[model samples]
Target: MADKKNRYNIRDHAATYWENSPKWRRVSMSIAFIAFFYALPFLNNPLVNTPGSDFQSVLFYPVGMYVLMAIGLNIVVGKSGLLDLGYVAFFAIGAYTMAILGTHTALNFWEILPIGIALSMVAGVLLGTPTLRLRGDYLAIVTLGFGEIVRIVAVNIEAIGGPRGIAGIPTPPDLFKAKFTILDPKPYYWVLLTFTLLVIWMVRRMAARRPGRAWDAIRQDDDVAQLMGVNTLKYKVWAFVLGAAVAGAGGVLYASQILSIVPDQFNLNVSILILACVVFGGIGNLWGVILGAALLAFTPERIRFLSQPRILVFGIALVVMMNLRPDGILPKKKREHFDPNWKSVEESGEGEIK
Candidate 1:
C-alpha cells in the first residue's frame, strides 16, 4: 500500500503511465474519450445541469468557448512563457471580422472563416513586431493596452455598428441534418468540440518538434536561448500568430452561434479570465489547461443560486487552490525519471549530476 501511495503521489504519474503505454492502446483510448465528449450534450443529466441556465447553451458559450481560447492562450503563455494580458484582442478581431463580413458581404461562414483567421494572424504580427522586444512587465502592459485598444476601436467604428455591434451573422450551413439554431446549441457544441480536438492534436504534434524545443529553451532563459542562436523574435512572433489564429477561429464560432455581438463583450476582463484558466491548470500541460478552463467556466454557473456572490466564491476557491498547489493542479513533468536508483545519489549528498 505504501509503495502504491508513493507511486501515485501529488504529481501526475498517470500521464507517465499513458506516455509509456502502447501506441495502439493510446489511440483506442483517445477514440473512446472523443466519443464520450461528443455524446455529452445528449446525456441530459440533471445532476450536471445548472439551475438558471440551459446546459447545452452553456456548454457552447462559456464552457466550449473558454476551453478553445484557453488552449490558444496556453501556446503563448504556457508553451512560450509570454505574459499576454491582451489576448482578447485577437478574439475581438476575429469576432468583428465575422460579424462585419457575414452581415454585409456575400461570403458564407466557411468563406469568412479563413478571412477572419488571416486577419487575426496579421493583427498578431503587427502587435508582436513592435512589442516582442519588450520583456516582463513592459510586454504585459503593452498587451493589456492592445486589448483595450481593440475594444475601443470597435466602439468608435460606426461601419461595424460601433457599440451596438453587428447582428444577423450567418451560421454555418447545415451538416448531416444537424441544423444550427440558437435554441439547439448541440450542433454548435459539436462544431467547437471538433475544432478543439484538432487544435489539441496540432499542438501536441508541434510540442514534439523544433518549435517546442525553442519555446522550452526560451522559457528557461531568453538571453541564453538567444546566445545559443535561437531566433527569439521569430519564435515569439510565431507564438503570437498561432495563438491569435486559434482565438480567431473561436470568435467566428461564437458570433455565428449568438447571432449578435457588442463591443462590451470583448474586454480586458475576458483576457484576465483566460489567463487565469491557463494558470489554474498546469500552465505547460495541455490537458491540465483544458480541465482548468472547464471547471472555472462551469463552477460559477453551477452555483448560480449564490447570485453575484458566486464571483467572490470563485475568487476564494482560486486563492485556496493556488496556495495548495503553487505549480498548478497537474504541473508538467519537466524531465523523465529513467534511473531507478537516482534517489540514492541525492541521499549520498552528491545531488543531481549534470
Candidate 2:
C-alpha cells in the first residue's frame, strides 16, 4: 500500500497541474474573444449577418448550454469515475420545474429558482439511491432507464403540456422593472458564462478535497476503497448530487433564456450528446469536456448543408477518435511520477515509514 504522505504529495502535484494548465488559459481567451465579437449582430452590423443568417441570437444558446452541461458531467464521469448516462433528466426537471412553477402558476422567476434547486436535489437523491449499489454497466443501464422514464413521463403527463410542452415562460425581472424583457438571450449568455465559471470553480474545489480522494479511491477500485474505510455509497451519492446540481443550474438557465420547456428537448438524445462531449473531450478534464461540447454543438450547424450525410461524417469522426485516441482528445489527468513511498522531511526525520 502507498503511504499516506506519499498520497498527499501526489495530490499536491495534481493540484498544481490544474493551477498551471495552459489549456485553461487558451480556452478562456477564446471565450473572451468570441464574446467580444458576438455582439456585432446586436449592433445591427449588416456585415455580421452573412447572406441569410438568422443566428445572431439563437446560436449562443446551444453553446452556453453545452458548456454548462459538459462541466456538470465532468464532475461525475471525469472526476469520480462514474458513468452517468441519464444526467439529462436533471436538466429537464430543472427546466420544467422553473417553467411550471415560475410561470403557469403564480410563482415568479426568482421564487422558482430555489424550487428548481430543491427539486433537482431530491431527484438526484432518488436516482442515486437505486443505482449506487450497482457498478459499471449496471449503473449505466439504470441511469439510461431513468432518463427514458423522465422523458416518457414528461411527454405523457398532460399537466406539463405533454408532448407539446409549455411555452410563454416568464422572463426574469427586468432591470429595476424597466420595459425591456430579459429574454433577449445576450443577457442569458452572460448569465450562463458566469454560471459555467462558478461550476468549474466548485468542481475543482470539490475534486481536491477528502471527498474527492474518496471518489478517486472508489473509481480506482471500490473494493479497495471499502477496505480503506471509505464509504462508497456516500461518495457515490455525492457525485450524483453535485452533477445533478450543475445540470439543474443549466436547466434553469435554459428556461430563462428560451422561456419555454418541451419534452422532446430532454430525451435520450440529450443524454447521449452530453456523454459524447465528456467521452470525446477526455473524461476527467473539464476544459476538454467544454471543448468537446463546443465542437459537437457547433460543428453540426456549420455543416448542415450536407444534411443526413453530415451526421454520418460526425459518426465517422467519432469512430476515428475511438480508433485513434480512445482515451479522448483531452485527458483530465495525465500520468505523473508515482512514488509509493516518497517521504517528507518531517516524516523522514521521524522515521515514520515503518
Candidate 3:
C-alpha cells in the first residue's frame, strides 16, 4: 500500500513539474511567435507605407508570394537536390490557367483555384516524367529549355492574349457575405497569410516523412539510394509534382491579387529570383528560405532611394553570400559520428558483403 502511494506521488510530482516547467515555456514561446507573425503587417516602420491600412496588404502580398515560392523550391532544390532552372514554368501554368479559366467561363476565382492546381499537377508530371531520368547539369539544361518553351508559348499564343498578356482578372470576393464591403486589403492579407501558413506546414510535414528522407537519399547518391530499395524515379517525380503544385497555388493567389497576368511575369528572371531565395535562405531549411524570400522580395523596394543602383547592390549581395557563406544563411548542422563505430562497422565487412 505504501509503495503504491509513493508511486502515485512520484507520478503526480512529475506531472506537476512538467506543468510548471519549460514544456509550457516552450509552448508559450511558440504561441508568441505565431502572434508575432500575424501582427507583422500591422507593425510597420517609415520605409513601408501604412497610412490608410493598405500597407499591411501590400507588405503581406510580397511576403506571402515569396514564402510560397520558397516552399515550392524547397521541395525541388532542398529536399531532392534537383537543380531546376525552369520551375517558373509551373508558376506560369498555374497563373495562366487560373486567368483563362476564371475569365472565359462564368467560374469565379474560388472555383478556378482547384482547376489551376490540377493543371499544375498535370504539367509537373508531364515535364518531370521525361526529365527525371536525366542527371545533374543535363537535368538543369533540359528544365531550362522547358521553361523557355513555356514562356515562348505564352508569348506567341494569340487566344491567351499573346505578348500583351491577359489583364482585368477578377479579385476574390468576400466569402462571408459581410453587409459592409472590405475596401481595405486587410481581409486579403489574412487570406494570403493563412494560405502561406498552410503551404509551409505541408512542406514541413513532407520534409519530416519517408518521402523527404527518400528524396534526400536520392539527392546524396541515386545509385546508393536505389540499392537501398528507394524508388528513385518515383520520389523524383513526386518532388517535381509537389513542387509544381505549390508554385501553381502561389500563381493562382498572385494572379487574383494583382488582377493581371503577363508572359513576362513568368519569365526566366522569375525563376532565377526564386532560386536565389532558396540558395540564400539555406537550401535545406524552410525557415531560412522564408527569410531569404523576404529579403529578396522587399530589399529593393525598401532601398528605392538607391534607384538603379539597387540591382548592383542585389548582385553584390549574392556574390558576397556565395564567397563568404557558401553554405547559405541557415546551413544544416553537421552530423556528428563516432570514428570507432564507423571503423568497426566498416571492418565488419557489411558493405563489402553487400
Q: Which candidate is the best by TM-score?
A: 1
Off by over 4 Å in 1: 1-11, 336-354
Candidate 3 RMSD to the correct structure: 9.5
Question: Which regions in candidate 3 have their CA more than 4 angstroms from the true location?
Answer: 1-22, 47-54, 177-183, 336-354
lDDT of the candidates, in the order given:
0.87, 0.75, 0.76
- Cα RMSD of all models vs. native, in order, equals 5.3, 8.3, 9.5
Error of 3 at 7 (Å): 46
Backbone clashes under 3 angstroms, per model: 0, 1, 0
- The CA-based lDDT of model 3 is what? 0.76
List the pairs of residues colliding in candidate 3.
Answer: none
Q: Write one digit per residue (lDDT tens) for candidate 1, span 1-354.
A: 123234333346777688799999999998999999999888777778988988888898899999999999999999988889999999998898889898898888889889999999999999998898887567899999999999999999898898888988888889989999878999999999999999998899888998988887777667779999999989989998999999999998899899999999999999999999998987888988999999999999989979989999999999999998755776776353345553453366321111
Candidate 1: lDDT of 186?
97
Could you tell me which residue pairs clash in candidate 1? none
Ranking according to TM-score, highest score first = 1, 3, 2
How far off is residue 92 in model 3, in Å?
0.9
Can you write out model 3's per-residue Cα lDDT over 1-354, one digit (the tens) per residue?
Answer: 122223223223544565677777868866797777777767767866534335665565666677778878888888788888898999888889878877887887778888888898899899889888887677888889988899999999999999988987777766776221234555566666777788878887887899979987876667789999999999989998998988888788777777778898788888888889998877767777888888887776667667879889998989998787665776543331223354354366322211
What TM-score fits each model? 0.91, 0.80, 0.84
